[model samples]
Target chain A: MTDETIRDVLTRRGLSRRAFLQVCASVTAALALSPAEAADMTKRLETAERPTVIYLSYQECTGCLESLTRSFSPGIASLIFNDISLAYNDTLQAAAGQAAETAKDTAMKNAWGKYVLVVDGSVPLAQNGAYCAVAGRSAVSDLKRAAGGAAAVVAVGTCAAFGGLPYAAPNPTGAVPVSEIVRDRPVINISGCPPIAEVITGVILYYTTFGVPALDHLHRPMNFYGNTIHDRCYRRPFYDRGMFAKTFDDEGARQGWCLFELGCKGPITHNACPTTKWNGGTSYPIESGHPCLGCSEPGFWDKGGFYKALSTPTGHWSRTGVVSGAVAAGVAAGLSTAAVARARQGRAQKKAASADSEPKNPTS
Target chain B: MPLSRGVIPIRPVTAGAPAGGALADAILAEIASALHEYLDTRQNHVIDLTGMPLSREDRQRIDAYLGQGEVSMDIHALVHSHIEETAYAGVWRVRHYDMGGGVHSERIEIIDVPEIVRASSADMAHSARRIEALRAEEGA
Candidate 1:
């Protein structure tokens, strides 16, 4: 692909700078940056040379790719033509077989050590990486080759960041996240069953502008994953009031009360679902009355049942009634801390309310 | 009768703001603080309402509190951008609508005039050159 800067693309498309600034302003929100930085962001997006991206898919269901196409802000087309030159993606590209392979090879060579390497799906390490392959080469070897010349790697979706469903139990392929193989490079994980569309867009925009953004312990961008879903959930008041939905059809459920009793894992599952939301800001799983499956975290598939209350330990714990020993401990610790904080906040608010309502005698 | 910002009713806040206004209350506080920050630093700021859990009530409350101002702009590009100055002089409510007229973003910006409404120097320069060239052709 030709080295076309954003300015060149905009000018050629007959779009003015003001219009692009609007997009930049919208994207500023996506970056979790204040509007004060909109002008700065606009300048960077306008002037910076568009980066080439090589998307590598592995042992996955391609849900991540599907989710990416649903991006609203800078929708997939805008992100592709305006912000990035998506040099190669097996699913998106038209050139197939040898021509497609040649394009990837050419793009990687041309932008060596400068291109953004985007990987979806986990890498299979077992049986000499024999589980997933393309053109007689394994996903593991191909990813290492792509990572060698990449400026930074973006592991999109839970599958590539954490061994997802394929990595569940009785592992045959011995699937591992991209970070395990691409050790020398910065692998930014955009983890979710398939991360929220705008989040994927936001991370790409941030990376394109500022390079690797701040990451959490799992190497996910802190900008999008900073707060736990429960922290920002609108139903937090109900949670504070200790009102919970015991069943799917209960009055509390209709009133949109806390789903903690019904196996909602918003307290420990860190994601932007509550904020950015899904289906173009419509709603997320929790908002739609389903308990969180903890799709973003590693080993979520094996972390007990989806409807089990946190640490109640009496209900379901996966079909086998067995939880990964480590995950159980971690969940218990996070839940206890959250419970304490909730109780303390509730008490403080109650005390303050009481003080406010107390009628006072004539002031001195 | 599609539900939109315009269609929503905004009851005026007369009783010195409501009690227990959780999310809505926090947002108003942010806007109030932003108004002051702009005054001190002459810097514009934006609060992305879309990124927050802004219920319909929260949105109306913020609207009722801010009221309305004199300036409102409609700029059409990839989508239709509507920017309206709130009751507070520098505070603006910016919303972008898709082709289908669905509101994509709802933001509160504190600025003299939002950048989206202002024509850039580069665009003006380009237009200026084009106008001059037109004059030259007429003279020729």
Candidate 2:
């Protein structure tokens, strides 16, 4: 199977075999795949025919694309574009005007029922979808046309997955996500304001190897987005000690205490920010002394103020209150008794010493 | 040396809010009364006591109790009020106390009945162990 030999493919791409192996290792760790599974994936990825991907951009700032381009180690961008046959990308494609549209048409026709549709922005549905038009076609029309025969659709950012800022309050454009438009196909939502770069590449690698990565109810990869940020927050000990940062630069904040009172969305927000971090896993919002804005979860924009504390149930404390009071009282009493006893012992020791030193033998 | 001591105010720690009419109000009143008793006893102990260093066992017991959230302890009245207003459906007043030569205050709020009892029971067990340790230390 010429397609199965990844080592040969990398050599063909002018990348050393060692560099290709390193990429494979990174993909395995990023996807949390076992070593054996990773080896299998490496084999499959090296040899499989490069899948076609069509990328569409709509109402967005292109931050997601920018984040993707910033993938640090071994440069995932070069690997993705060079290894995969990315047929159409509005931002990166050489063709434009009639040529670009015709290129998209030809790719879809040739790779029908095989291509992967990747969307990076939200589609505005208001005013008969006149809010966002590409090549004189509404975003909704463009998306539907692209999705009709694609094997899968990957929503690459918060905008493409949940309408992000475009769908924030008022939503002048009446923006909707690609999933709403492409209901017929399997739509995977890789949600984040601009998701972690590693996570984005990891998802692509999983799809490239295993056909499709396991997804959560929200269509996010379960391995990465399953746990809340609070579960792995470094300052959890301070929170347990009841130390919280009340203000931006208060003593607690300076001490690197829990940011719960400072409107940290870690407890409620589900993402790998605490674990995966940002800027090549160097630091996340919480670690840098700022509270999480929960940019990854759906409807985060509408979920009250960013600094407001979540209405967590205090029921975990009913028993705690009584038990702690009694314990405190008992311990206090016991400590007092011990101190009194120790004081008495010291006094007695001094008396004995005085008695021994008395001049009773002075007459002798 | 600065004394590591604090005072806590006494407050009624009721469980949940009143449901609707007279029955709910009565239940709330009952819970408040029980919480008041617990707080009053604890305060009396604090007042009668003088400069005594807390033991490691005592601190551990207090930690265990706090973990259960059956009672809320604060070093300042402001923190107490905040806990009472935000965490519990009850009222409380701050009281100051002298610790050795230093002075500090705490706000003491009663947790709901069931949780308080459970926590208190665990605390009592811890206290028994501490009391035994104190007895041994005195003998030595």
Chain A only: TM-score of every candidate?
A: 0.86, 0.80
Question: Which stretch of 10 consecutive residues in model 1 chain A shows the poorest summed lDDT?
Answer: A355-364
Q: What is the lDDT of residue A267 in candidate 1?
A: 74
TM-score of chain B, candidates 1 onward in order: 0.79, 0.22
Q: How far is A259's C-alpha from truth in model 1 (Å)? A: 1.4
lDDT of each: 0.74, 0.61
lDDT of 1 by residue, A236-309 (tens): 77776788889999777877778888987777676888887877677888778887777887777665578888
Q: Give RMSD to native, each candidate.
A: 11.3, 28.9
Determine which window of 10 residues in candidate 1 chain B has minimal summed lDDT: B11-20
Docking category of candidate 2: incorrect
lDDT of 2 by residue, A1-364 (tens): 0132444555556544434544564455556554346557777666556666778899999998788776553254346553555678878778789998998898888778777788999999899999999999999998888898788898998899878899887789999888889888678888898987778777765665565555655677765776566656667657657779999977777777888877776664557776666765557898899988878766566656777654432222212243234223323443332344335434544553465343211001
To one decimal, what is the Cα RMSD in angstroms of model 2 from the true structure? 28.9
| Model 2 per-residue lDDT at B19 | 18
TM-score of the A chain in candidate 2? 0.80
Query: What is the Cα root-mean-square deviation between model 1 and the actual structure?
Result: 11.3
